[model samples]
Target: MYKIYKFDEIKNELVKLHEIDPNFIDDKNGDYFCIKDEDEIIGYALVKKIENNYLLERMFVKEGLRYKSNGTKILKFVVNHGRGKRINKIICNNKDIENFLKKYGFKECNGHLELDNIQCVNQRVTEGKKVVMSSIIQNIFLAILKITGGIFGSSRALISDGVNSLSDVGSSIAIYLGIYFSNQPADEEHPYGHEKIESIIGNMMGLFLLITAFELVKGSVMLLISGKFEATPSYITILWAAISMVVKFFMYRYKMRVGIETDNSALIADAKDSKSDVYSSGGVIIGILLSIWISPVFDIIVSIIVGILIFKEGVSIILETSNIILDKQDDEFIEKIENYIEKNTPVKNVHDVYMRKSGDKIFLSLHIRVPKDMTVYNAHNLADGIRESLILDFENIKDVMIHVDYLID
Candidate 1:
């Protein structure tokens, strides 16, 4: 919006004025003046020469200085200078600013309304489509994974797949539902979007993995204690174990490929679990074979080994997922954001940066320091620009909050 004017065409002095006060240069006849703090321009004003009166064309203080009466001081300078020039009447164009100028005896001109109806409508339509498409794709993928896993394996195996299938189901449902409600714009119930729901689902998936591990361990231990190993294992048991191993090996590869393509942690974990199942099933097959050559006790020992492996995988999944739900910060992400801000903004420094993660989404908060003499509005606009730029460049960022601070004593 600010780029509508050609800054290069104006006089260097007026260019300086426009930088200080954006509304200062227009077709109206005016003399642009800048208010300096030491060597730096902190505010700007434009006084237009009308037929018999001087109009207060425009005035603006740099963003950081607005709350310090800098605007009022600039207005006073325009009034006093106008009186000395024998200009009795002063006019102000903006109605909102007219009230502030009235204290200096300036009268308002007719109000002007700026409308951007087309832009507003287009933005809403685009946002709506994004929400709809994301939801549909996520739900479809989840259903496919669940159906495929269930049909190919037993119910217990499907359930024990843990981080792979279960995690996918949880994350997909959460993203679909979260986006549906979060895209509803701000309401009384939730001023912020429902993005955090992704984290909740991620945490739930982690817990599910833990449960799955426990059940697998319990089943393995029960087999060991039941003295089932004392009897000679049947040929059917070895045949089934061989079949399960082959199926699981292929499933492991397929799940791993999908997980890598999607960059889904849950899916990756599930893929690992499938790979582990291949080994465990193979172990069972070997244990039965060895019983014929060695002793039945080897079968019981192998079962215990499989149980321990399941327990370890469960603990790993819980730790990773819990970190995400707890909003643990990633140093790499913070460094990326900091580098972006320093490169794009006129900010002198950035500090107190905080990052929060909810599943794959990242939230950022930081303080940016600019020159001390700028007005509050200018500082705010700069912060807004930084926020907008980050969202455009980083796909995973869900929200950002910036605090503007002056770089002076």
Candidate 2:
């Protein structure tokens, strides 16, 4: 089993960080984080909270994972973690990493980007047009944190957990946009309403889920091929895993509440995804801990499980949303509709009932038989009455197209 760098090994790096920013570590009183495998230390990060601002003193990943998404993930975690602390600005002097920071909505001011107004941005994203933006930020942050920890700690299981987060982030934008567009009111061109756009967007998210599943398997394969195990994953990673699990669970609850309040199925799906992440992170923690006492192979097994989960979820989402897109018939729901219509309205003998979805909104088309001798004028009036009855009875039923036809004796 591999091991992390011991205290003596990390001292040299700490000295360098001190030189770069003396305020970063107070020697007797300061904060810094180290990353390591079971064998040796692989990376370290240092930061200082200065009043309303944060200063990133130094961050480094092992040469093997350096310059890869592994390193980027760690850097992203640091940035978001700082933002989460309500830091008005984050200042970093490392010119080499400037480009990475800029890509994540950070802008250079003078020599560095001040992590200022991060709280403002987060507030706006949560409250305004970008209601789902907070989920994106969380996904990216937790994904990188786990991946960086996994890389240095040499825990394949943790990496898999991170990969799961990547899947969510990949699907989040499409899902968010779907919710946003579905909220639009019915117009001249789309009289039935814009809710269908949500269903289409949901279908697109299914594709994203599949793509991310593929990514999870690919990463797992690469790890297995290397056959390098860092046996003694650092305590830091365990701490990170625990923290991420708690945070992810809370996010699931938050999103679920929003979903219920707004009655948006797309958002509810997103919440379920977040809830799964909470458990996945829990799995990562269990794997790493078991590796210490049991056969280190537990990590690999966990990695495989995570991939399977990603694949299963992707297929399920694709099948569900695709059915709506393809207009698959739902006999059970049709029965419910028929029962409701007969009970509430004068119309009888419901037939040709059809249902499909657009976003969370359900559209129904059906024909009902009235008295064969009923007049055309009466039939038209009865159709209007049926549409009104269904609309009032079911909350999600947006519009009903009823074709009046003669009752067969």
Candidate 3:
């Protein structure tokens, strides 16, 4: 006979369970139960029945006491609970948990079960947020420095560069909001999930960049026409511009790494924006140097060129995001995906391999050919397997729809 600890009392104990299972992130709202031996809690399990499926979110036993019967008891208890709840499938992505479930008759499927139809936690989304937040914080400090240095040093070009940095802060804020709403688990209203908003975020960023470009262009033209395109050259202005170039180059590389890792288009756009910042800061530096040697008119001229370049980039980003929203097909990626599916899954034929991007998330639709004699359940499981395989292969893919057609004799 043993004692069972309630969720509230032993929930904190599960924090250390991450070491046992890295996928076992502790969520307070999840149903938690702990197996206790007298006053010491030896094991814990967490589950959530989302939509119509059950998610075995996390379970673990203490390292020292794992060889005992505590783990077995917890597994039996949760399995029984799942059965009682009419949950046909309980899914886990962790290899250890998956192997353990197999011993109890849970077979590996093509795709992991979506708990109650809710999407699983996306690690890339988490990483994306971290990258965006870091960009915002760093941009704030840099913008302040550039704006302060520009005003005091009377360098219009540097002030405009400072404004560009400020715009990046706004873009990052928009990206954070996009990532936030996009990750809200798929619901009845939107079975495909809420990530499509990222394309809109991309479009907004594009529009913002274009507007900033317009303002800079207009200001530079006015200064040039008025014959007042002169900046009182200050070492402080050049110093800040040099600092900005270094900072933005680092940010560009960091965000680019995050963008590639997450396969997130919005973050990639942010990375490109950071790259543009590097160019803008570089332009500021060159303008300051020229003003020192040649004429201050070069500063305004360089600002105008920078504005035109940013406008060109803005158009490019808008077109890119627009293509995503329009469901533009990429034949190259489609072929790659089909080949990947063939290599990884049991399915022999894949057709109509259509791919679309919604923000950082990818939506894939494909028809799969299966044996005519296969049972519906078997086919469904195969489809699930294929889906999981695809997700594992492509981290950006959010939703996959596999249409199973009977293999004609």
TM-score of each: 0.54, 0.62, 0.68
- In model 2, the number of clashes is 18
Off by over 4 Å in 2: 1-131, 185-191, 260-263
**Residues 90-144, candidate 2, lDDT per residue (tens digit)?**
7878776677667766677886765566655323124323547888898899889
Candidate 3 colliding pairs: 50-115, 50-116, 51-116, 110-384, 110-385, 111-384, 111-385
**Which ranges of candidate 1 are over 4 A from the true structure?**
1-192, 195-199, 219-228, 234-265
Candidate 3 segments whose C-alpha is farther than 4 A from its true place: 1-122, 341-348, 370-385, 406-409
**Candidate 3, residue 263: CA error in Å?**
1.8
lDDT of each: 0.56, 0.68, 0.77
User: What is the lDDT, from 0 to 100, of the residue 254 in candidate 1?
Assistant: 63
TM-score of 2: 0.62
lDDT of 1 by residue, 331-364 (tens): 8778878886776556659888998764345678
